[model samples]
Target: MLEISPAIKNLEKEDIADNLLHYVYNTKHLLSLIKKGIDLDDPSYLSSYRSFEGEVYENFIYEKLLRYAEENDYITKFVLKGFHQGKCKAYANTLSISEKEQIVYRTKSREISEFDAMFLTKNNELYFVEMTLVKSVLKLRRRLRKKKALLEIIFPNYTIKSLIILNEGATGAKQFPSYCKVWFTKEFSAAEVLEYITKLDKQKLLPKDKINSKKMIEAHMLKLHPFRYYNTMSWITKTIRANKKYVIDMNFLMTEKVQRYHDLYNKFYVGFLTVKEMKNILHLKEGEYSEEQRVVVALEKKHSDEIVVTYYIQTTRKNLYLYSFNDAKVVKEKKDPYGITVTEVFHINKLMNESYLLSISQVNTIKKLLKERFKRESQKPNEK
Candidate 1:
């Protein structure tokens, strides 16, 4: 027999509800109503209930229990079904004997019933669970017996177990049903139920291990589809296009593999030139060659040659003059003549679709010079 003291009955309900509410809110409330002495079994009380209409009570309980098991670290991946109070059956047998002739007859019977919760743990073990804040010990025992019988028939492969969470103090030392255990609690706290659930999970009572493996395998297989690749590429393209601050450098074009493929394709594959290569490809050199003096007057012009600036000069005195972009004409005339002077240059080249060159490495210095000359022709107003 399972009985709870009057004082502890509501506490049991509250604890269960609190634990469940951590995962399912509305169910917690309904359990709260139950704890508050609202008769859930009463039809009138159910009629006024809102939240999720059409099967609200069943849905609420189902979702709450599902979330409860999940949150408490119990296996929740198993299939779920709701049983109405009078829709299931308990197994029973009756026998009749004939008095005169030694004839005997027997009959098997069943009655419809419902259970509060059912769980299948990782080990494929089935648990028939029943909960009540009801003070009737005999009634609780009867309910547990009935649920146990049905579970045995339905889940024969599983080791059926029953758990009765009650608020009543211990029901003396009476033998409970064959496959039943009861947990008595004094108050409603989600933590306690979660702890109990965790213990149960650790015992390998839930079918979590098998379910997780199956789910993982299925997910991995899905990733092998071509659609996944296509979607990944599309995502990369969209992300690159969205970021306007950065440039895409495909320097892998210089690798041996890329070069080999490009050669095999015979110019059909340009092999992904980098921003630097693109800049070099579009560079134009501009310098004045004096045929009679056998000297070249070289300078980087700005704004389509609208602004002339001499960066280097070879004079008749065998001297070289180096001038920076911001230097005055007098400063240019004062510098020593042939010392291989270096200056930073900024230019936009149209060859790679009008991209700007900020700084060039020593490897791309010639390209930088060519771009400086091209900038002189089509420099934009924003270049300065």
Candidate 2:
């Protein structure tokens, strides 16, 4: 039983239509719609509806939490605290929630683990809160266990409990860990929520002896979910590309092993040479050097005369990846949803092709990619 706020439940069609109209006007699509005739079935309206549809459930839960917290006085404030990062405090409007915190691994692979919302009590008790519309209990269980294991590595001393808020009428609530507090929407009361928080204070912390070391935990996680290297790399690549900020957060560091990556990222952001300086290094003029979104400059030598540089350009819609090699050229093809493609052309020089003019550490990363990709390819026939 999930409960939505009365305010949200009472939203009228006119109210929604007004918001849709606002969205179209702000996006400059309203004039187009006006010219084309006021069709409610237009893609612009559909897009607005789709976006609105996605937020409804999220708003419901957030509004529910805010109302409960305000009525019950269950929390002091919402704060974001990381393992090595300082506390980031915000005025408490919702629950004591911190969202999308990451755990960086110290292994050679540099894998990462990210958790959703965390609710922290004044007494340092933590609730790893997961709010989901997913109906499958098995999927939920697997995800929570992995998240718990990762949290243990970073917050071994904290009394970390689990609170899973599933959609109303979802089943298999009894299948979750006994320590986990599972609540279906509309089923639980504010008093029960308060009681859940109180009980965690008296609950025993996880035995330090039972918790595995970082290496052991990594091994165990890999065993539980195979193809871990590929999965981790994909996650990192998607996260970085989506953010488009290029600057890696300094606070994500947990161990010395990941410092090299931080340095590499810094090389792109903080160590980029100016266009004039780049021309001096390469002995090329304005017409001679290649330029795409920006003046594509040679950052370093790959082969004898071949050079490559890593940079990103901010476009009207979003930032895009642009790299330069001696013989490099941009190829346009079918644009993905993000309007990017596998379109960078370069000479097949061994060093440039193998590592794309990257550092020795980056070359080692290519080696890992080769190992993982070929391993999967080799396994494909066995599945048949």
Best-fitting candidate, measured by lDDT? Answer: 2
* Tens-digit per-residue lDDT, 1-384, candidate 1: 223344333332432333222332234444455457877567644643333231233333344444445444344233333221112222222111112111111113211234455555666566655655444567566445434543443344677677666544546315565566676655333434334433535432322211112211110111111212122222332332233453322233234443332222111110112333322222312323232211111223232222232333333343544433343323334343321121111000111121222222422443354455456536656543
The whole-model C-alpha lDDT of candidate 2 against the native structure comes to: 0.37
Q: lDDT of each model, Cα atoms only?
A: 0.35, 0.37
Instruction: Quote model 1's TM-score.
Output: 0.27
RMSD of each: 32.6, 17.6
For candidate 1, the lDDT comes to 0.35
For all candidates, the clash counts are 17, 6
Alpha carbon RMSD to native, model 1: 32.6
lDDT of 1 at 37: 82
Give the per-residue Cα lDDT of candidate 1 at 174: 53
User: Residue 168 CA error for candidate 1 (Å)?
Assistant: 4.2
